[model samples]
Target: MRRNDHVILGQERSMSRCTRVWAKFFAFGALCAPLFPVPPAAAQTPAQGLTAAQMREDLAVLGQTWARKDRSFTPEGRERFELALRRTTTQVEGMHPHDFALEVARLAALSGNGHSAAHLPAMPSLPVRLWWFDDGLFVVSARADHAGLVGAKIERIGRASPEEALQRVSQFIPGNDAHRKVESTPFLTNPRALERAGISPGAETVALTVRDRSGTRRQVELHADAEPARGHTWEVLLPEAMDAPGRWVHVLDALQVRPAAFRSETDLEYEWLSSEPRVLYLRSNRIYSVDEVRLDLKLFEMTMKELVDSAPQAVIVDLRYNMGGNYLNTILFAQALPELVAAGGKVLVLTGPVTFSAALVTAAMLEMHGDERVLFMGEVMGDEPRFWAEGDLVQLPHSGIEVRYSDYFHDWGNPCREAACLWATRIFGPKRPISLAPDVRVPTTFADYARGADAVLTAALALALDADVGCAAQRVRGAQAARLATPAGRACVAR
Candidate 1:
């Protein structure tokens, strides 16, 4: 999903610098060399605490780099960063060593670029794993010692409510929209960030208020995990693979969690939601991980062709699980989707908070293509067509904290969303990003989350099942007239 520095050697050579910042570069086209890959070269985190001088040095370098190269940087974001840096440095100068990295990290987040973030060094955390669902934040899982916390609705951590804590932690996260932060909150809600941000008084213990399934609300105290803490994974430290597995899916499918999207063993999966009229369901999790064994243009083409040939009553493509990959793959897939439309099968594209990056582009391409047969449903996109992406990592010297920043403007050929127009304002400028708003805003409320409900997909199929196939194009696209249909009736027509 990332463009390596070698991308500068190919079609990207038209520019004077590297194209993408996703450092986890893969071999695609001319980008043969992986630049800034961090797995092998991790510096040992220091055993001792950091001094104010070291923190200051890190901020200086980070600010300079971001101000110089961040594609989404703006005067407002810069002003906020400078103010936060000045105010926070003075506080960190005398604060505990535990708070140093978080303090500086929050300042980096002031840049407001989704590709840019202040990464925290690995540290001990509470045992429970939390995640945000449409209902609210809840404990998804926890160590054996804290197993009871699972399924409890998270009301507060430390002194702040789950919502309040998320707001504070979001200052250090570079997200284009609220959904981005909402989808990623659990991963970022560690003890280090909580303590440093003053949500928790000390790192040793945390206080929480949660509601059990019975709706009983009470306070609970849990000690942080022990020292020699497990190191952070590449997904946590970097921006590229933020599609780390989450439990909200299981929570949505309360009875038995079905394997679909990223949770599935395979990247591509298809099934029949119903028999009569035949509602087909398909999900492509990640652009790069499509085949499980090997994902390339050929595999994608085959999958699309197969899907179209099935000739179901309707087709539901679940992209909610897709965390992005090669954008070109979307174009390739689009080329083959007309067959499904021509076959009189309606198309419903499902999205959610996790739908991001290249995925957003794919959704935009389908929407902008003006296809009458296609429609989008679910949460608004996490990223946008007009966004700063292809980020490069800049690690701080003292703390080994990684700072990612966008270096390229991904313009989806939209005039109003061009880089120049986006950056030309004091309001709604680059710092204040934009994302695609879905046509049908479907929410997966917990009460309706049957093991196989697939709420969004279910909702789309409900709207589509009774509609005339010939009207699919005009219905969603707002065309003056419905698209033409074949002499053969919509049902019983061989695809």
Candidate 2:
């Protein structure tokens, strides 16, 4: 599904310098002299190869350090921080580092607060991002060469498969008792497990086994290569690349959304080529857009209206490379779908972890509208609580460590009777604190889809075509199919 616009959540909008804590988190690879494989040290080197205990201690200390600081919120900041905290703590305890980081991103997203983020280490190799759908992995985007795996199931990565790997890594990471998709990654995309398993970029040839649409199994060998360069092209930055597999994939994604003339509108020579009829598929290279000076919402609205108007069914919303922007805008844009708002054509939304904040809101709203008759394909990031915050930062004058505080709160549970009062006075809202709850949860993971795994997407496509309703059920990824097929594998194959 193509998104119509980008919206900033809460309208409480808000970037950045490095501190010692930032350095420690980033340079952890070099700081491991006596942490894990070794011991603690006094020489001032940071720790690496952290165990579960160590990671817990580190997070706790980080929190305590913030609390001890003598900082006060500017009423608004206090409300923002508290609301953010409430929103954050709801999911924080069990989140893996990446998931935790994403939550931090969401908090930061509330105020556009740059200081609030889960620190990450710089990693090479363009990562393969996954979207969870009904416990199945659906590839959202990745570097080129690995495009074939976009719709393939990640039954195996190297010698170990998905289940085995997730279990082993869970010990060191923190997350809810639910799924352990990419959203659950504690740091550096399961740095501990990947390192322990000895996964390396040099291992270009990876073995993959996935089930086909007919329930037959096939084995494929993928050559992991860096995405090729497409000059200094805007399309180059597109979620997929502009060349090779990406070029074709972009065209495919756009076609799925809607067939329109995609042309560039710059006086300067731009490589962004339009499909026919002005359906513009902006390439994903960086977050910066060619129209660098326009309000994101207007641009999105204008473009979407143009494409959708050309052909009602011709519109296909592609967020494959869309990381995230104004979360609120994401939802408002979906309003443009006339079919979705129609009496019975339920909205068909494709979401994943990459779809955060406003994007998540859009999905939720479409689902909520009921009129949109919206159902989602692909994998979802997970249900997140939405709350507004009045961001106020507490900076440790000495260490330059910054902590965020909320000055206000917003709750979805506020009764309509006091809509105005609740909007103005509620932070936790004295009721159910959960912000947004996913009606249907999809467990998208990175390895399976990032490598071009496609069973889930195919399933979604089938649903879209069939207009199947009430298909929502607990998601179990490969486990479900594997179990269902156990008897068939035993009897039919033998027969």
Candidate 3:
């Protein structure tokens, strides 16, 4: 969830240094705020319900702000926004604050920009934390009071099935289908969001139909927690760290071992994996620097230097949990990574649903510059290669809800063409169309996670250790052939 200011392109203006700093400060504060005992400012909305006039004022502000600040806003998008705004304006009179906020979000989602959305402060959330595993939606973690719900597969939310509820909530999530799916998992546990989506009635407690570990189906009523729902953090997905003292209970609390991928909490970490070929495992959780500027770049360079000195046969660059940060700081590393691989060695890049924005950019950069020796493994990236990004947050005066706007466009799929692309190319160099589909797709199943198994890492390790070129080449060729069989992959191949 780390964010950074993107380079301004063409006639597009940049925020003032003070404004950027404050934006980051506030965003970090909001992201890291604890989930209980809402702050005084955020608690104001519940005390005094937002009036229709206030909602109208906020809608106007949202429109004006996006018009002035969002460069990606086109004539077609403006027309859609106006229509949606007029329609929503008619229903605001008797709508609840949560519904109003979602309507505002719907307006932003119309832009089709993943970075754009209205963020409600201190929004009420259910006690249980949900995650979408390969099997289905399941409760991964929960408050101590609802600990029994952990590991239970969610069958239904209220009257709607889990998939139906997710589809309903996805309308308000900005981004491609992949990004929407990633964002919608958390909203499944938000009573206000579910109510706004019509997946659940506006009630004090919502009914959840779940199948427990023993395959027992039952309904459980969960009330909203006292604290507001916070933004998604990848750390919350780590099984080993799920149990927090006496407050929360994790599904894998009984497991004593932790996966190698979940061992590091740092932004950049690298170590040698004990294998036949001597694999170097590098995990980048975020593209951020804590104490020093360009620290990620420095660490990346140092890691590469070590790879050169030791001449490891294989390198794994893990970006599964890296949401994004400043791509400017890591683009050079991406550009240089391909050539650094040892002559007979292979480099496998690990990506997942959280590998997005700046992180996605970096991965694409690597793929575009890399040769056959470089490969990708893990799930599809969070967002599409071509998308809009790079804008600051705007807070509404009346409701204080923050709306993120996007002003810049990025197309990592193709070479520079437009003004924005040209401007970026001037700094980042020529780009090439990139197919983000992994050469080897590895999904994390609930069973793998329940036992602290790192399936993706294990696959990478096996591939790296296999000295037989026939097996490795066959696997890569088969994966590529399967990808070419799909419509999207065929298009990528044609490109």
Candidate 4:
């Protein structure tokens, strides 16, 4: 399809939490937490019937089994976690299952590992789709008008707040990642609670008290809507508001090839909207090796070359759904911008927590190339420069689990310094002691994506056209006849 702008949700998981099986008690812990209060380590106890000794044995088994296969964790880290487990049992004796699971999830998060997280039960597809990030939870797709909820924190769903419901549901579902406890819970963390609060399948409407951007408290009655047949999560067709002044473009890089070493299901897939005269929007869905190098600069170069050939007044490069592949492609994409290189124009880039690896590299590269002509839209770029490796998935014995980490770190030492090697990072890059920042940060919401509320894209197009008009006037005002001869200017005139 020739979509001028496209939204691509590339499902690229370096590690699959779904396939791997973990401790049942951990699952119980994840699901049971809603039933009782999560006690502090010192005050906690195992289920009422299970002795402290049994809890210790169960924890030992889980830790020992997990440790046998977990190469990411240090021996010291494992030992510390084992000690934490032993200490936790002293508190687990009299606790409810839900309470115990919460503590376990807490312990897993404490492991300070990205791979460690709670797993929630499979949700019966609700009309809501949420994109979870460290900063906050975003409603990417929803059936509710949710206009009042565009940016409001869904503190409570029905009766229980998001946190309370998560604590309750996590008792049964055990997560695989150990880094963020909050990240592990699924969208249906508190279905029962949400139902009680009047957000159930049969409910025609939901009542919500929301806090607006102005910090004013108000109650909004939202009508239930149907999910869009196509696209991810919630989908809403947008209306043209030509006067609005914000633009955000998600430039997804769909170039690059799979390295010969680790070619999986997805390799060298390029599907995007290109060659539009008014605006050139390119999205890179994956990062693959262009040549021998890890960063494929040529693919981005080609994308820009295409845009320059088409000579669109504005271009939006969306890398929001791009999962790390070739790091250099982004840099190449920045260097290839027609405005910066040809028209002396500008590009607007859309980003978010979903922006990772080569995507981050691309964002960083734009800054380095003196491309002030570029603007960033969406939530903050993933602060982590994760070292990505396409290698063999090694399964550890006993645990029946597989783990993947990169063999090297890809760092672009410029405006945004990245890791030289792969270690423990906020996202996945080096331990740079600090994180990178975005030029202009915009939050992503369900309404924005649904309504095609691409503030960045709109802004980029406006700025591009505005700049183009001014530049065209300067260069070709009295020389209309001369401008007509130029193919690049001809399309703008035709439009």
Q: Considering lDDT, which of the candidate structures 2 and 4 is the better prediction for this target? A: 4
Winning model by TM-score: 3
The better candidate by TM-score, 3 or 4, is: 3
Off by over 4 Å in 3: 1-47, 230-233, 239-246, 467-495
- Whole-structure CA lDDT of model 3: 0.68
> How high is the lDDT of residue 493 in model 2?
21
Work out candidate 1's RMSD over C-alphas: 10.6
RMSD of 4: 14.6
Model 1 / residue 358 / CA error / Å? 1.4
Worst 10 residues of 4 by lDDT: 33-42
Model 1, residue pairs in steric clash: 20-390, 21-390, 21-391, 21-392, 22-391, 372-473
Candidate 4 segments exceeding 4 Å error: 1-80, 87-108, 111-128, 131-155, 158-278, 288-305, 308-314, 325-340, 370-373, 385-436, 445-450, 467-495
**What ranking emerges by lDDT with the best candidate at the front?**
3, 1, 4, 2
TM-score for each predicted model, relative to the true structure = 0.73, 0.42, 0.82, 0.49
Model 3 per-residue lDDT at 243: 44
Tell me which of candidates 1 and 3 scores higher on TM-score: 3
Writing each residue's lDDT as its tens digit, candidate 4 over 1-495 gives 133222222332222232123222123322321110111112122234654455455456546654444444456766776777668867766654434444455455443433333321122233434444344444333333343344444555555555565554443322222212323233332333244323443334545454544567666554443322222211111211224333111111111321111112222322222223344455554555423322232343334334444555455666665545544234334555634333555566667654554566666566555345666765565434332222222322322222222233344442224343432222322223223455566554434343323444444444555544333332222121233346554454444
| TM-score-best of 2 and 3 | 3
Q: Ten consecutive residues with minimal summed lDDT in candidate 2?
A: 34-43
Instruction: List where candidate 1 sits over 4 angstroms from the true fold.
Output: 1-46, 94-98, 187-189, 227-266, 274-278, 290-294, 298-301, 308-313, 416-435, 448-452, 467-495
Candidate topping lDDT: 3
